[model samples]
Target: MGEPDVAANFFAKPQHLVKVNRRRRMNIWRSGQGSPTVVLAPGFMAVTADWARVQPALARTAQVVSYDHAGQGFSDPGPLPRSPARTAADLKAALVRDGIEPPYVLVGLSMGSFEVRHFAHQYPGEVVGMVLVDPSFDDMAKRLLKVTPSDQVWIESQFTHLKRCELAAKAGDLRPGTDAYAACVFQPQPDLTEALNKTYHDMSLQASYWRSLASEFSFAARDKADWPLADMPLIVLSAGDRERPPRPPEEVEAIQRVYADAHEQLAALSSRGARRVVPNSKHAIQWDRPQAVIDAVREVIAAVCGGPA
Candidate 1:
């Protein structure tokens, strides 16, 4: 079959672009209607569509919103570095400009945990509950390094690869069938529609996309002090089936131990927090175990709404 018209397919769905500021506009997909809105925050380089399997189901119960970060998906590029604080501020501005009220049940995936946690910390009154899906904890790399120091080489190599992709995209040399493309761009996901996959591919070719990803990846590894989540309801979902990089079995076990401990610490941040180990799921728990995410969101919503959880 011939390639699809990605632009047409991508635009077929209604686009809601809210101006976060004069220089920045964010694209958001909102659905359902109820108080204590559920907001889905995507991981590093992930767009709103990544929550395709989970968002709709949660929307059935409470107002649900999924959005792309600045320089991602259909959103306009924002300031550089894309630190968690900056992303959190952009999200708050976008939500306000879009007229989505607070008292939210924030659902964060992977690196998104950083942004959502920062958002909650910044404006605790706005966030009533949180569901962290296979989250990245504060200073996770540093903590893990203490246990599995050998992974330093792997981490540096990954960063180098990201830089190369950024430069290639800037030079307009990251094309299909090229080594850079193979290394930088992921293959089409089987779960997404052909048109969506095409849109993802086209977006990957943009220099801004690579720049955003590289910036987020760099900041994500930096050490950040942990803070309390107060008594708000929180659920930390850890991926039981996380894939390990090439490493010795003992080293891998050590890393997993550190990971589990970190997640436990995250849950402990809240008085009402709890942690769960999701089986048969990889890092993208929403894709592998959407029901887990849906259930977690529902649970948080119920708690916030003073209903059974």
Candidate 2:
């Protein structure tokens, strides 16, 4: 099959294509209206549609923005090695180009936590507060490695699969009925419409999509020094029900303990920061426990407004 028509059936709702640079434009969605604009950053390999459950509710109270990273959704492909710093810079450029002024509340899900944190570090004065949903902390890999050396092996194995997918996509072999298609494309999500699911699957078949995924995955496994939050109003939401990968029960328990401790430490990054464990939820807390994510954003917005949190 040839490239899917991304605009024909997928954009039922309005979206803006903002130029992050002369050569690249990112897809952005905006809702509601007010100051301290709330920005939603999706997790690794996730797109703006993943925030369908949470963004509208938060938008009711403040302006909310969500976008797909380059090569991930409707956006054009960007430069290689999609590091956190590069993602962070692209977000800043998109917001500016879209004319969304800051003094903003940033909400990051999973790997997105790294991008938003890097954004805050790069433009401290622009961000008022943050909410990290089931965030992946810096040094998490190292801490997990200390827990079990097999963690490294697991990480490498994941990359191996990703590389295979990348090669298959480049070869146009990620088609229906093939093992590559089955392994590379995710099953349809209950929350998305049939058309949206098809859009996601089409994107999955593109070489650029897998390239971005692999690049981000590589950077995520590296050791990045932790930066200071410096008393910013922040909240770290942890998924109480973590989905375990294929591993020994004892190893899983040890890893969970390390992650729990790290979550607590992440919350303590700011004097105003706090940790909330969303029970019965997995890593995608925004989908499983959207209210928790919404409430955290509300609290942070309130804190930024100097009101009750």
Candidate 3:
């Protein structure tokens, strides 16, 4: 575990800072104002900026917050082995420390879904709604291994390369292709500015971020368990378009089917839970189809804010 320390650095100019303990302080960004705050959690190796499109849109109608997980972006590194439970706890603590009281609408993207789901499970009264965008479900790794062996290899290889990059970053020698990796993950952003592009590149090179991602991936299966449905609105957004290299059409179709099935299973977490497919989107739905994410959040907000049931 990381030792408690003061948040002495402001190198990144974060909008809000909350000390979790003597050793860690979380950086938070906030916009707009209203009840039932919308908390946005970015995917693996991603920062709040990844929500560049959806967060602003959602903020217009409600208070929106997006923060860096410890060790990602401007946040300080936290304790090791960042399990979902610990991550969820950290988020709760940060919210409390900053006086951002519940009820909150937790919106998580990709790997972030695990943390938000755990948060709702642990603090049901605090979260009024949830929006899971292209979430990662339990047993995902094993399922992928069985259904698409080649795709599994590709996934593993990507992680392995990230691990190497982490090692290189630790040695003060960042590996090549940082910009390329950034481009690959954050592509199709015609609106990205030069400064934000540099920020993304810098974040991708952070060894701590990669380490956090690897830990999250390693513990995913171990964290699998039945999640009780909360009596709140829930929306699971799955991508209609799948990203893949040239492969057998049947294989691609099989993988897509499995993913869609998994997403539907997530919607079963609540009585009000529903699944929606974002047309022409890949895994990064916020980036691929920001309106889909915005709409889902708005729907949940409306339901929670007494607009409709």
Task: Tell me the tens digit of each residue's lDDT in model 1 across 63-125.
Answer: 888899988889988888799999999999989998999988898899999989999888868
Residue-level lDDT tens digits of model 3 in 1-309? 221111212223465778988889998877788888999986786766677677767777788888888888778888878988888889988888988899899998888888898888888688889999988888887776677787667777777866776776676565455653543333323445555555556776677877877777677644663486656899999988868657788877777888888888889888899999888998899888999898899889888887941
TM-score of each: 0.92, 0.92, 0.86
Clashing pairs in 2: none
Worst 10 residues of 3 by lDDT: 1-10
lDDT of each: 0.84, 0.85, 0.78
In candidate 2, stretches whose alpha carbon ends up further than 4 angstroms from where it belongs are 1-14, 186-192, 223-225
**141-164 per-residue lDDT for model 2 (tens digits):** 788898788779889988888889
Better of 1 and 3 by lDDT: 1
Which residue segments of model 1 deviate by more than 4 Å? 1-14, 185-194, 223-225
Q: Please give the lDDT score at residue 43 for candidate 2.
A: 88
Against the true structure, candidate 3 has what lDDT?
Answer: 0.78
